[model samples]
Target: MENNTWSDDQPIVSIQNVHKSFGALEVLKGVSLDVMKGEVICIIGPSGSGKSTLIRCINALNDIQAGSIKVEGLEVHDSKLDQLELRKRVGMVFQQYNLFPHKTALENVMMAPIKVLKQPKDEVEKRARALIEKVRLQGKEDAYPGELSGGQQQRVAIARSLAMNPDVMLFDEVTAALDPETVKEVLVTIKDLAEEGMTCILVTHEMGFAREIADHIYFTDRGVIVEHGPPDTFFDNASDPRTREFLSQIL
Candidate 1:
């Protein structure tokens, strides 16, 4: 299908004929999608459909066998540029809150800016504290990851990604590990980020959140984008049979 029609002005991320393989298993096949600046786009599909792989490739976590991924007009797969710098520009939040077990929330959030970016201690602390407050974890800054609840830990992870001030944020099933009660808090934090116009690409199964917050939704099946459109169009009147069936079961 024509996936490019949904393009708005200039795309912040572009994947063209992308393919990824792990050993003998091929996970992604000729997948192409565009994400506009400041848009919140969610990729939804059945397990092992390459939704996570696609997002990983965007930030160079997974190397694709073929095809090109461009982020902020820079080709990510190109060896000419520094991968570390590329990752700094494209921050990622994982399914499990990957905070250091020994580090407190504040330290977890401050680590990257201080170590990788080499920001001064005072500047790092200032920015990290502000971000902790932004995610509604003002007092929990000193709490170690072991002491925080699942949702609270995930919020810390989000704050950690924001510490880098990335242009694009990639969320790979961020709320999948949370209890239902805790999911809303994390989703609320994400919603606030969306409202603030952070360019985000999320891999999620939360249909309700996708409908309410996503600027666009991409439905993938068997390593291909079966259909893609605005949330109103895709969720309400999905064109492809695979998409329709998937939505029916979830809705």
Candidate 2:
């Protein structure tokens, strides 16, 4: 798969023997993974399993203590220029929907494209409006963050990320904080992205969604990936006992 160009070209992102620690706690230990273009890979595990941290490291949100991370052939360690450019290509959606409280939905989506990408103001507004409509928040473009429901706020967050036109999207438990009724709306937005061939790496506990959407499943325990395979193999026939134990509790 690694050699074939059309289907198995160089991975969009690669992490090799990655390690990270905070004081006495070592969060990631020799973790490695590859994310190919247009493939959706889901990471599932218990809290404190380092799933979020692993995703954060890929976009350099969390610095790694050891190992190498490459995004689109550029190494992502100890280089400010490369890291800055790498982040522009990788968009992240967080659990909390970190939209600026002061900005309206439309402005929030336009900020990065205008400031960082140097897009013309008129063009940025046009794209932002289209993205807001795409996420089904058309009439709420002028709504403040406080005015929208959790689902609407999250949809705005997703639109803001998409406004950048990223090559890879990382979703870090994006539905974790939403109400049960609101969760489906966000998940539906994600489902649409998957159907559109977006390359996504998701860290989530929604096993049903993972089963339906993930091309590959990764089981992480204590900061290490114990098993990884196609969803059928990983969910039904995982070789590791730990993977089975985890699935039994959730599935």
Candidate 3:
């Protein structure tokens, strides 16, 4: 197991005693994690284990009721923190390829950099083209969403996120919508990013992929992180009964 590069000196994203809820349902309970710079972390658990909520909270997409989240030293839970700036620093990709119907692939990738970031059109276009190519979508830049396959659309969405040039990338079940055959292409693109030292936090169920690529794995259960370790220790020597049961069912 070649555990690759990661910085332990400074954490890029920090989650401390994070607790979130939806009315009576508490989704995340006292979950804590510190993702170092250039680290790749895969979060695995059954549905409704607060994995998605945790990732959302990291990007300040959802507010945490208790505890705090900090991204690149910006306190996410602080009322004074500019969520706009936080989002620019933390890019997130949802499972659904939320591309606009009227916009072509290149347009979809360039829009955010132009409108939101206020980057120059020519500069943004240049960056967008590079991002699209990086995601392996060079040939289909002008194609509409209707023209691309689900996997291709997802790749476009990934390129769209990269266009922002965010410091941390958060993926929430990115390949969940793609058909089994199409899943590999999207996974390959993600793996490439991970290998290139992008600080990434993934909420996914791809156990084998996680084992192969993740520097660390966090197993969440019933709104808590029940077990966590590097891939070797987390995958092969799970200490908790819940972790063992989950691995047995999934693996």
User: In model 1, what is the error at residue 227, expressed in angstroms?
Assistant: 0.2
Candidate 1 residue 82 Cα shift, in angstroms, is: 0.6
Candidate 1 wrong stretches, greater than 4 Å = 1-9
Worst 10 residues of 3 by lDDT: 1-10
- Relative to the true structure, how large is the alpha-carbon lDDT of every model? 0.91, 0.91, 0.90
User: What C-alpha root-mean-square deviation, in Å, does candidate 3 show against the real structure?
Assistant: 4.8
Instruction: State which candidate has the highest lDDT.
Output: 1
- lDDT tens digits by residue: candidate 3, 1-251: 02323235768998899999999999998999999988999999999899998999998778889998877777888787777788888888899988887999999999998999899999999988998898888889899999999999999998999988888999999999889999999999999999898999999988989988899999999999999999999988999999999899999
Query: Which runs in model 3 stand beyond 4 Å of their true positions?
Result: 1-8
In candidate 1, position 10 carries an lDDT of 72
* Higher-scoring candidate on lDDT, 1 or 3: 1
lDDT score, candidate 3, position 113: 89
Q: Which ten residues in a row have the lowest lDDT in candidate 2?
A: 1-10
Candidate 2 per-residue C-alpha lDDT over 1-251 given as tens digits, one digit per residue, 9 for 90 to 100: 23324333888888999999988899999999998999999999989999999999988889899999887776777565455577788999999999999999999999999998899999999999999998989999989999999999999999999998988999999999999999999999999999999999999989999989999999999999999999988888989998989889988
